[model samples]
Target: MSNSSPTAARLSTLDRGLPVWIGLAMILGLGIGRLMPGLGDVLESFTIGGISVPIAAGLLLMMYPVLAKVRYDRLDTVTRDRKLLIASLALNWLVGPAFMFALAWLFLPDHPEFRTGLIIIGLARCIAMVVIWNDLALGDREATAVLVALNSLFQVVAFAGLGWFYLDLLPTWLGLSATGLDVSPAAIALNVLVFLGVPLAAGYLTRRVGERRRGRDWYENRFLPRIGPFALYGLLFTVVILTALQGEAITSQPLDVARIAIPLLAYFSLMWAGSFVLGHALGLNYPRTTALAFTAAGNNFELAIAVSIATFGVSSGQALAGVVGPLIEVPVLVGLVYVSLWARRFFTDSSTATSVAVPVTSKDSS
Candidate 1:
């Protein structure tokens, strides 16, 4: 008889050693990029509304399974959590960008292009991969879905204005060199629609139909476990494609990439820790706190990269900086998932810990 623990038994081999899989995927991507430099161009040639179709496909695939796992009927519970809602808004919009602005200038003041790029990244709050991180850490899936949707809406409405504020106005005020970011609301909206909206709709529809057809128990127990692993597969695929596309850029400019990475590393750690502590103080339970921290810490790197390339050209230092965002972010956030889980022990197990945080099962075997 097998002596494997129940938790280990529940998790697939892919999920059990996710970090190893992700690392290998990254290495494979770099190899592909270095060996066949033109592959990125070939894949990117087929783009819709200025977004790459292949990348979009991976993102949709990555998002759909996680979103489908969300108990949408329970979102009203998340929405009513005023502490979580207000904290998420404040941390994402007000604190996140400002902190990145400070870090960019502090770390790479001499490299104006990289500095601007870092600030651009900061201005773009996360709308995509935070879902994966939140789920892995056993966060409140319903709350995460709601928060991601909210950030998507905010990104479309406020991205350009914030870009101007951080990239232009604030820099000018600080006696720093300023550059204009020529982004339109329509373009931003298109990104949100494709990256977030499509997958969201698909996931929602999937859950609704599956539940209707097979009942909630079968939909959650049978359907969900089957699809859950695909989310990680999509993540691995996206990582490979992304790193492959940026392989030459990363390998060629090791020093510059390192320089760009330092502040990013600092930024991710700071935002996540700060948000986690704040959530605890706000009396949020572990699941909601995990959701809050990840959503706060993650960035919309896709939008940042697009904006950088559009504004400064693909070969420019700003674009390199943007490329480095996800490269640094992926590994760091993966590590933070462990940190969040370990920290979960600190929270009181009682539902009376706060009015905002509803009771959630901490374990997600799927």
Candidate 2:
């Protein structure tokens, strides 16, 4: 489990063996997907509020643990530290997504599917993953919580405009689009609401109720630890289903994965480098700088996958591009956490020294 024991689990996931877990998640997903491709669609999902979305039944089932430990009320603390909030938001949304948009087009001109994947994945920023990553990075708890809340709210408002403007039409501007595409704001919203909204609400509700019936400690100590692994395992399972959903496509165009990944890799490096330089110029702390850098750099592959599936069919090269992203992102982000730690040395600040690796749990998730 890579030092994943509950009582003393690293606040972030960088304790020792997270790369192995991320690798396992990817391998297990691909393996199961390869063995039972049809199994991915075995579960029939239902629509809520007139939306046809993947029930994310497995992912929903996984949320109980991830949400159990997060104390939602602590969200107020995020407002107290405005400096970190401003830095993280600026870097994550503006700089990061822009870099991804440019690179996705530049590196993937011939491949529309992969380009859409890069665009969708890039436009979407952190809501859930950052909570875990921030914890993993030992970032400022209040500040990170605030950013999560802020980013989610921001995406809700900005998703349609930026996603469509940047991903589809923007490509046309660059003389890159072979076909004129219509971006469905409804589909994007549906994906966000179902994949992200439901899991988060379920997590929060379960925690709130458990805290009432037994005790916060019982919920935190007993229930959450058990459920935490489920969320991750479910996440891996969903990835498998997602991969299998695109199995034939990925197999058909093996090089497409690398092609899509190139821009993602470049965007990731640029965002990280940009944030670190920005933080240094602005004289932020290590923890804060890492938070800024990673918040911009890492992606929300789950929602990205949902959007790809809805917008471009599950097996479309675009969706395949989205799937390939996390395969690169997980290990790379974990590796970056360590690299950020090393990079912290260059910052010459005490707080930067603290925010180096990814934490396993998000104690402040609201």
Candidate 3:
């Protein structure tokens, strides 16, 4: 299901111009919202029977790229970096969320709106931005692929549980379900597969065909190169429309965003620092260090958004908070990528091997 090395490189280009594309998506979303409000509303809805399928389009639309790069073969190779993977899980699901909860509880309490937003951002892990951040951090794709897949699979359960539990901490105005662990596991699981699995299968299949037909070179040279940028634009446009839709809400509460930004900045710095210390202590080489540090720092927002919309209403502040998570995540992780690269010189190969070398492909990761 995964692409060859060339295909990986080809697919990666979409992520480079992320900021620009995100800006364009904002503009496009605005235009769409204004020119075709009715259609826009429809596009926003994910109806089933009597139910409103909120953010359905956003969830389904953004998965194109996530699915495109999915590699079925990744499971076999995941073992090469077991320590790094375990560290990522510990940090992302456990330590990172814990920090986010504590930070939200600390900073944004006076402003309920921003406090709620921070909680949503904290609980939701990631989808899109992590891959880009991983690359920027000089992480191995094999490692990223394994972690990404596992993260996606976990979001269904984590989203509702974390959202309900944490939002319950807020004042009663939020109306988050504090009652119990009430969301059905099966339903959430189905939605995850629909959003994640379908695209994953499609990406796997596409890679399968491309690899067989013209060979890996053709895939890298042709199709992947073409789709990569378009997909980035697609994801960007999705965010823009989302922002345009929420433009009024966001602008009105500039201070709220300002308030939330601090803990988010703090969260990034803390996670990065933790990873860097751990990477060196563990004796990871440059590539492994990059992978280790990034795995701790990045998130999976898309899955969180989907779960948020499912739990919180479409227009609910909780859902909006979830959307805002990537605003902080993308650029910060990109910065960390270069930071990891610079830190590479500090470690000797012997240190990397003796320190970081647990088991593996035996060479420095690119």
Query: How badly does each model clash, as a count of residue pairs?
Result: 0, 19, 17
How should the candidates be ordered by lDDT, best one leading? 1, 2, 3
> Best by lDDT, which number?
1
After superposition on all C-alphas, the RMSD of every candidate to the true structure, in Å, is: 3.5, 5.2, 7.2
Kindly list the per-residue Cα lDDT of model 2 for residues 250-322, writing each as its tens digit: 5657787778777777877777778777876787776666667777777767667666666676557776787
Cα lDDT computed for each candidate against the true fold: 0.84, 0.63, 0.57
lDDT of 3: 0.57
Question: What ranges in model 2 sit over 4 Å off?
Answer: 1-15, 40-67, 71-73, 178-190, 195-228, 341-366
| Model 3 lDDT at residue 272 | 84
**Candidate 3 regions with alpha-carbon error over 4 angstroms:** 1-43, 46-75, 136-138, 163-182, 306-312, 340-366
